[model samples]
Target: MHLDQLNQQYGLPELSFGDRQRGFPVIKIKNRFATAEISLYGGQVLSFQPSNTQADLLFLSDRSHYRPGKAIRGGIPICWPWFGADPDGLGRANHGFARDRLWTVRHTETLANGATRVILSLQDDEETHKIWDYAFELAIAVTVGETLDLELTSHNRDQRPMTITQALHTYFTIGDIQRVKVLGLAGLDYIDKADQEKLKQQIGEVTIQGEVDRIYQNTAPKLFIDDLSLERKIEVCNRNSTTTIVWNPGMEKTATMGDLSPDAYQRFLCVETANAAAETITLAPGERYTLGITYRLL
Candidate 1:
């Protein structure tokens, strides 16, 4: 929908729609508890700042692309149908096509508790079939308030069963990556993506030192990020998610990413809630699954 139509139909005192930087249409929401921005182009939440906080909880790269077919370099990017590289070696996009397509605003409301709710949806079409050949519908409902709550639901619209892996790839802003210690993953086993997919165990709390890319399997439902420099602890809680991915490009890899500066690694860390690897989902026809997560600053 056009910006004017969106504002006409769904705009509220706390929510409005308009073009953002580089002509990207977005939904801007502000309530008594917090403020947030959601880009329709990628169906992604790009910003969320609580009223009690001095900084945003999410990280977005300054040099990130704001165009079609390009995934924004930060925030909560949806990795759907598949996560990471092409699992079938078909040479497709790294994180699937959901984040590269435009999404329709399906619903919006202001909750009784003063939170703002927005739902964006995408369905399989000719263009999507040309890539993956499946009939499906994906919807992400974002509730913005003192805490950010997200629920991604996928439904099988085809006659056959569908298998997929996905994630809520959350890049969290921090005072310093080195000072962040991720709790709740102690003694868990992980697939070290940066170390040639080797299996490793977390001895204690996870920390970022180099190019860290590990997928913790069968993860705990809740995790915490202790940011000593920021003097805060961010709580990550999830349901129906079996895997957690922790990543940072470090210095050397950051130099190659045009969307990220060399020092960008120090400002954010990714702690993803996902159904990937051994946790991939298979849905029968007319079936659906939902992945839910909530982020709170404490």
Candidate 2:
């Protein structure tokens, strides 16, 4: 079906749920120009279909059948306070608590510049504090135009200082993993997951094969994912994030993900902009920080 047609037909469902459990509201933003879907949960982009009829599903919801009732999946999982693997010896689960919680859709408006903005927010609640200590407010504003723009803001409400790491884990669709090439992060220091301590290493252009997971620290201005089969290039630009992660759980790991088909890895690649390792932020009381990423299809 045509992308615009799908938007006009499905837009956003008033109610979206998972197995009787109440899910977040879906916000639909569309005009003659562009079409996009945002979920109140985690303030994630459920789907983005440009004028060209290209659809980019940012998360993989079909990867598992047994929901841990905790760990979140599908569509831009928000990793906050701790990016990956708990550093503070906190066993608060993988990624963090932001994804599983419900977010509020604050406002939606069409800008004069011909772009539409949808803002969503989430504040710390009694349930969240049980897992992590601290009260904070998170705002995620997604602007859709010729390109898809995501802006994340964190406000510290506690009096004490807090250090945190976070990321916008984005899973981009592609034609084939073997036919794709990621440009940028060439010759930069990265943590190789294959080695213990993730031994620091320097690398160049990214090539996919087997189980590849590396965190590239102190990255560059932009990265490009060239999909030869799709005949397209996805340009990623980041703001306020120093580390970028490139990961693809190959055939073996793909099999482990219950919701994913054994060959799912061949059609998706994750190039996430993150704040990990040295990029961790220290937010004082009343302080606010912002991080952004703009994806343009060329």
Pick the TM-score winner: 1
TM-score of each: 0.99, 0.88
Residue-level lDDT tens digits of model 1 in 1-298: 6789999998999999988775689999989999999998879999999997888999999999887889999999999999999999999998899998999999999999999999999999999998999999999999998899999999999999999999999999989988999999999999999999999999989989989999999898999999999999999998999799999999999999999988999999999999999999999999999999999999
Model 2 local distance difference test score: 0.76
Q: How big is the positional error of residue 292 in model 1, measured in Å on the Cα after superposition? A: 0.5
- TM-score of model number 2: 0.88
Judging by lDDT against the true structure, name the best candidate. 1
| lDDT per residue as tens, model 2, 196-266 | 54656566678898888888888886889988878888999999988998888899988888777888899
Clashes of each: 0, 6
TM-score, structure 1 vs. true: 0.99
- Candidate 1, residue 161: the lDDT equals 98
Off by over 4 Å in 1: none
Cα displacement (angstroms), candidate 1, residue 87, comes to: 1.2
